[model samples]
Target: MAEEVPNSSNTVPIVGPEFARPQPSDLTIIGDTVKDTDGNKVFKVKTPLFGLHNKRILVDSNDSPIVTMKMKVTSKHDRWQVYRGSDLDDKIFTVKRPSTVQLKTRVEVFLKQNQTREVSCDFTIKGRFMKRACRIYVGDSTKIIAQVHEGDDRLVATIYPNVDSAFIVTLIFIFDLINMAGTGI
Candidate 1:
């Protein structure tokens, strides 16, 4: 079964029958994974790439920088440090994968104000990255914000109306990075 996530920060508007499906006029975009099936990753000069070094940034269409995702390289626990841009200020949130062993993808999200390491998560992502399927949810994992479906050539993300689509795209990009990193989370 597929998962559905609703945007908590934004309210979806009533859609007409004409806009039932995404149209060309819609603000939708496509992203491609830059690696081959054999696990060989390569980056071309002109092709847009996701740079994950000391600072990670996703270069979207027209070679424009969309979001900058920062993460710690030598951390004992898996965590997405920060996300720049969007109305949520420069500090979007932090994603930390639990240390407990599990087969599926489960991570806890903490908002910018959440400095203390509390057991409660502001949001959570649950799904399987190997299948290219995942869902982002609000606190307590009830309300969903976005979802990413796996495709043969690319990952398809259906972002809800009134939500920051680019933010969802960035999350998908980060998922690809962590999944491709061979961390086995």
Candidate 2:
């Protein structure tokens, strides 16, 4: 028997319906290009070589900016904020570790509307970064929206239906940055 995917109604699509594949979609991220399982490029990551603050832009196949992720330099938990398109003021969501002293890699996401108090997370990411695997769940629940694991010289993300691929990719990007910082990379 095949495993069942979580119901799609439980989550919101960040980018749009077009990015929410009806079936589980696998994407490979190598360097800047994000390609589907069939090897067709779907998205691109634009990283600036030199900047006082680390920032990255996720662009679609047409080179249109989907989201911009930038790290908060003063955040003890290594927080990152994602904004819609290339406009930094149009913040969409934020991702940060639950605690700065955790032994394992764990992150929590909050939509822009929920950032004021942040009493609860909109989503949670838990896994072992050294193992190169993680699962993104809805809030603190077990309803997984996506899973990511390391691939040969790249990372592979499997996003379930109704979940935005760009959102998942942005979370994964933040996850990578957090772990890289931990290793002094």
Candidate 3:
């Protein structure tokens, strides 16, 4: 039988049994991030920009646009939305900071399919923007799907192979925005 545990709020029960972290071999991410200038940093993945927009895009090994991220200006939450393609309507998720008064950045992700403000988080990104560190978990579960750490000049992200690279990229971009906002730089 599967085990059912209550969530952080202790309101709704998490549906299924707990999941174990995937083995490193099971990870599909290339785990590469390189610098675009000076060659001081090494990136396992390549992020190349082609056009102009408030947002930026990153291409995969096939040169396909995998993730497009843009920040929203008018929202009180200071939101950033990540789409699967160039089209903003093809949204995968939105990351928003709680408010400006807090010290450590608190970001919540709401998937396009689950737009309810009251629903438990579809995925929660927890980390300190100042430290340039963060981890993305699968929904409310403790299973981490991706993570990022500070690098020489660039941020390094580790994405689980089974997860979408674009999704991971968006998470990293969200953290970058938080770092910029939190530091007031």
Task: Compare the candidates by TM-score and give the number of the best one.
Answer: 2
Would you estimate the TM-scores of all the predictions? 0.64, 0.91, 0.65
| Winning candidate number (lDDT) | 2
Over 4 Å off, model 3: 1-53, 116-118, 182-185
What is the per-residue lDDT of model 3 for residues 1-185, given as tens digits with 9 covering 90 to 100? 44223233322112111112232212222234433234432213333355433465655445556657677877777787777656777876777775666677667777877765627667777787468777777676776766777655546566553454445555666566666762211
Model 3 TM-score (2 dp): 0.65
- How much is the lDDT of residue 166 in candidate 2? 88
lDDT of 1 by residue, 1-185 (tens): 45454434455321112222232112222344233234433211122255544455544434444455666677655677665532224665676777646588777767667737656887667787467677777666467766767666555555555555455555565565565563321
lDDT of each: 0.53, 0.84, 0.56
TM-score of 1: 0.64
Worst 10 residues of 3 by lDDT: 11-20
Off by over 4 Å in 1: 1-54, 60-64, 85-90, 182-185
Could you give the C-alpha RMSD of every candidate to the true structure, in order shown? 8.1, 2.8, 8.3
